[model samples]
Target: MPRLSLALSLLAVLVPAAYAQEAAPATSPKITVDPRAIVDSMPQQGTLLTGLYATQATIELCSVEAGEPATTAMNAHRRQLESEMRMDDATSAAAYAAIKGDVEKAGVDCAEGSKDRQQTAEVIAIYSGAGATPAQPASPMDPAAPAPSATPADPAAPATPATPAQ
Candidate 1:
């Protein structure tokens, strides 16, 4: 009888311990993204709002080819844009469509080895915050800091070199 009670107590304790081990939640690897890198990589010539919209299109299109990390980054960035920009559903949809149409019109192809694919990869790297150097603050006293120039700025226009500071 004593042996039977000891066996029952051991069984009760051991079973629950084993079950608790099995029921414990699994930990997943953490993902980190650098906001500064993402912001620095935005198209500098346009209004920041327009650049963010275009970035959204880029992330959506490239994520199809770029896979999981891009998708994760895309979701994070999209949420940030929607919240920070205060985009209503209709406005967000319209902006996405317009920017995506413009990108397609510009012949962006996400296929392997294409120039567009390379650009997309670069953009994804920025979004992924992988191997991205931290952006240095611009200082007026720092000669290495980029000087302001008389540059024409337009969202739809092709990029042109800024005039050299005299």
Candidate 2:
């Protein structure tokens, strides 16, 4: 009977530790999220996407370090970037492009941290509205429209034109 009780106690103490270990990884952060859902659901498409990307990256880094819950880390990251960057849809779009480049570079940096990866202009093409450079703002004032002359054209200057070269 003593042996049975000792076995039960051992199980009680060790089972929880084993269960705790099983749950340990869950506590760590997650990098990937349902980006599409977030993007589609957000009222501000541009800002959310950018913010999401930045948050994901931050969560990944934090997870790699502190091993906190991914969702917690993700929320913290989103708040941090939103506050620190003060980004709107337009700004967020711009930022996402930049962040994507940085994160890609980070991967290489982690592996080699030596050689420089040269990025070409083609690789960094900016896709503004409609995948075309945002239509040059239709100049409000027409270029063809004549601009007013500064000097009240020396009307006399032209008239003195032919002092008949006497």
Candidate 3:
């Protein structure tokens, strides 16, 4: 019938318009990391990572803990971890390179923040050491000793950002 065809035609035209209207607003979803939280967390996590790598290295290098072959394998793994840590450090540096803009936008003062944030930020401030606050009187780590990268809790996981509180 003509009525049926008209109805179909009208629906065909309206459907696309309706879908376009339903689509989300164009502004990219705001990423809501509390820069202070990240700044706070990094120090504790970084220190733990450094300690773990140092222990592993010590155990590997010592003859008492492992046999020659075992030591070799451990050394190899330790090297791999160190390499990964270097990559992570680089990534962290890159991430923090942009920190000033992001942190200020995220509403944190780079100079004085929370105690936890300060602790974490101190490490970064040391890592950066480009006239950042609380200048490093000494290097954070010994030149001869290196640290390891952080391994994920679940390798298969794609980390999901947390939803902001309403």
Most TM-score-accurate candidate: 1
lDDT of 2 by residue, 1-166 (tens): 9999999999999999999989877555667777565444444644554646743554343332322343454456555665565667687566666876777666633222222211111111211111223324545497755567776567667534545565
Candidate 3 per-residue lDDT, tens place, 25-74, comes to: 67877788775664544555455445334333333222123335544644
Q: What lDDT does candidate 2 reach at residue 122? A: 13
Q: Considering lDDT, which of the candidate structures 1 and 2 is the better prediction for this target?
A: 1
Q: Model 1 TM-score?
A: 0.43
Where is model 3 poorest over a 10-residue stretch in terms of lDDT?
A: 57-66
lDDT by residue (1-166, candidate 1, tens digit) is 9999999999999999999989998889899997666464544322445655565576567664555676687677676766676778898788778888898787667677776655556666666667434345868898877778767566579887789999
Best by lDDT: 1
CA lDDT for candidate 3? 0.50
How should the candidates be ordered by TM-score, best one leading? Answer: 1, 2, 3
Shift of residue 113 alpha carbon in model 1, Å: 2.2
Predicted candidate 3, C-alpha RMSD: 22.2
Clashing pairs in 1: none
